[model samples]
Target: MTQPYEVFVQWKRGGAHEHAVTVTASDREMALTLAKRNVDVRGAPVSIWVTPRSEIAQTSADDPTLAPSIEREYRNVSWYARERQ
Candidate 1:
């Protein structure tokens, strides 16, 4: 059965990989080949990575429980203003 794969590409040596696209394939090898042909058409990628979509875990940004309950002004830069003489 085919599986969904997330494609990531590094445009330069030693650069962080960025999400390029998604491809469906029966296995990892075919996923890589398909991603290369489809997403890297310009030959800009220095490296490529294909990961199974099922393997990734993510949290929702809108989750209210993830936010801090108390005020924390120290975390913001505006809290550190200089005092006028």
Candidate 2:
């Protein structure tokens, strides 16, 4: 079976880029072809990137290692919640 890969695309300048698609392909060339085809179907994408799925280091589904140990009041946007009371 072909290796798993992930694709990302930039739809427009200054727009926050996002994941576009995921596909299995033999190599980068094949992945690019798939990405281009998707771009055509989804309209023009400003930029594209394809990386092997294994290359992406990510947090585990059940891992909270990145969570802050202490609660931060400044980080709370819900401060308005108290005002509404």
> Scored by CA lDDT, what does every candidate get?
0.89, 0.84
Candidate 1 regions off by >4 Å? 76-85
Q: Which candidate has the highest lDDT of all?
A: 1
Candidate 1 clash pair list: none
Q: Mind giving the per-residue lDDT tens digits that candidate 2 earns over 1-85?
A: 5897799888889887688789889998899888788666888888888999999999888786777779776577787677678
Top TM-score prediction, candidate number: 1
Mind sharing the TM-score for model 1? 0.76
TM-score per candidate:
0.76, 0.75
Off by over 4 Å in 2: 75-85
lDDT score at residue 74, model 2, on the 0-100 scale: 58
